[model samples]
Target: MLEIGGVSVEDHLWGGRIMVDLPLACWVILLLEYLDTFRLEVELIWPAKWGLVKLLYVLDRFLPFVILPFVGFYNITANPSSDFCRILFAIPCMGIIACIFIAEAILYLRVFALSGRSRTILVVILINGIVVVATCCALLARYIALATWDIPRPPGVSGCKGTFTDGKLVMIGYGTTLYSGILVAVLCVYFGIRLYWSRRPGRIITIFYRDGTMYFIALSVMSITNVVIAANLPTGFRFLMAPFQGVLTSSLSIRMVLRLRQGAREDMGLTTVKVPDIEFTPETSGIAMDVPRTRLGA
Candidate 1:
């Protein structure tokens, strides 16, 4: 049996299958989720308003579906050309990049709203987030640039047959992601603490904190696991967790938007799910939103 990276080539084929199947599985589950909550989205987000947040939501929600076909194509297209594999790989990776960037923007809006519209907080976040995301983008380009497809793969082998020499670049990109996610999570916690100390946390505040905590915990664990895998594991398993990361981040981030709107106290002459004076708009379909206004003593 031929060995690649001390693992049998047979196992490597399985990894390729997993890479294709995992994302397909996630998409099926998420599509079901999207359908299940579509009523909520229509009611809570669709009619709220058009804004950056709505745009982010749409991209985060639907972009993965666009990339799913490419994933399947890359994995199942037997004996594809190096150029074809390169193109297919880049398509899905680029879509993932867009998904991740949109997810970050969504998180940024969440943290900003939690800070009560503090200009100081917003600017600080701008600096940190720019640095982290920029680093990630640069490293991702390097990783993809260095990646190669082993043409004429062994008989009975399938998939893109792609591998990169410097998995460290990818590990570093995810490391930056981990750092940025923790910072956002910590900020959410800080604002939550402030709200609790000041008075009874509003219905939305309690919800935000609960969801934010869970998001961060899941993000951290997945990120660390991804980094570890990228560092120490064979290419077969390096990105096995990427699908899960995308599903969790995009799904929960959108849910945070929807749930906040669904639970809003519309009787207070308020519209939109907001924190303090910060008016970050999250959109779906309906749910009776009024003109977005400053809430929580804005």
Candidate 2:
């Protein structure tokens, strides 16, 4: 049994091929949704908060769209030289790593802020994040190194075809999946409880609650789908769903920051989420005059 993408080459010869265009369509829709949101992001959010985290946030916005075309193009093109293959593979690989970590960072910051910036909570989350990222990186490196250079071309397929060289890459893939899934799931629960009990929701918190929940659920489903498909399906079918993973995670990451900033600008009382400043009117006597201030009260 000869396998180029973990599927027996015999399967390709027998006319077995998964519908790769489905994921392409999925990504196209996701990218369109992302682009629709981009204008609001630039106008309402990008101006005020410019930092490393924000940079990551922006990258998360655009990386999935960038990656989708590359992956799709590679799928249709003819086989390339070994060096070219490595370069082609490296682009999406690096994008995936960046997206995961950047999205994770944005999430950690959200949780940290929501937790009232507790040092202990931040430390614990950071420690766990570091371990997950490091382990997954090592696993991915090994998977790529061990991958077969030539991916078998399926019958009737117009373009190049390939997948991970080793099945063990599925382990690393889902490891990262579970890591992000658990973290987002926890945030969803924590905030759900918070949103449930609070009598009055701050504007930013309300936006966070709605968007975060949606993001959490969508990403969780995608990650689980990735795991199930990669582990149990034929190898050709496995890689087809890969690109959509970043779509929501990236969209939500950027949307989180944008919504937060939008909330802050629209609601004067909610500025403390990112930056906190307290203002006081001149005091005539012993008492401070009317002061405009914002603080985390809940």
Best by TM-score: 1
**lDDT (0-100) at residue 296 of candidate 1?**
39
Q: Which tens-of-lDDT digit does each residue in 9-28 have in candidate 2?
A: 65654422234465477577
**Model 2 stretches with alpha carbons more than 4 Å out:** 1-27, 150-166, 191-199, 269-298
- TM-score to true structure, per model: 0.84, 0.74
In candidate 1, which residue pairs get closer than 3 Å at backbone N, Cα or C atoms, i.e. clash?
A: 41-285, 42-285, 42-286, 43-286, 43-287, 45-283, 45-284, 45-285, 46-284, 46-285
- Model 1 root-mean-square deviation: 5.4
Span of 10 residues, lowest total lDDT, candidate 2: 278-287
Residue-by-residue lDDT tens digits, candidate 1, 1-298? 7854455788777776777888889889789889988988876677656778888889999987787678777888877888888898778766775676677778777777666667998898889978887787788777778887754456666677766775888788778888888888888778666644656566566667777777788888989999998888776567677777877788888888777766564434444444222253222211224444555332
Model 1 worst lDDT window (10 residues): 280-289
In candidate 1, how many Å is residue 230 off? 1.4
Best by lDDT: 1
**TM accuracy, model 2:** 0.74
Candidate 1 regions exceeding 4 Å error are 1-9, 154-157, 265-298
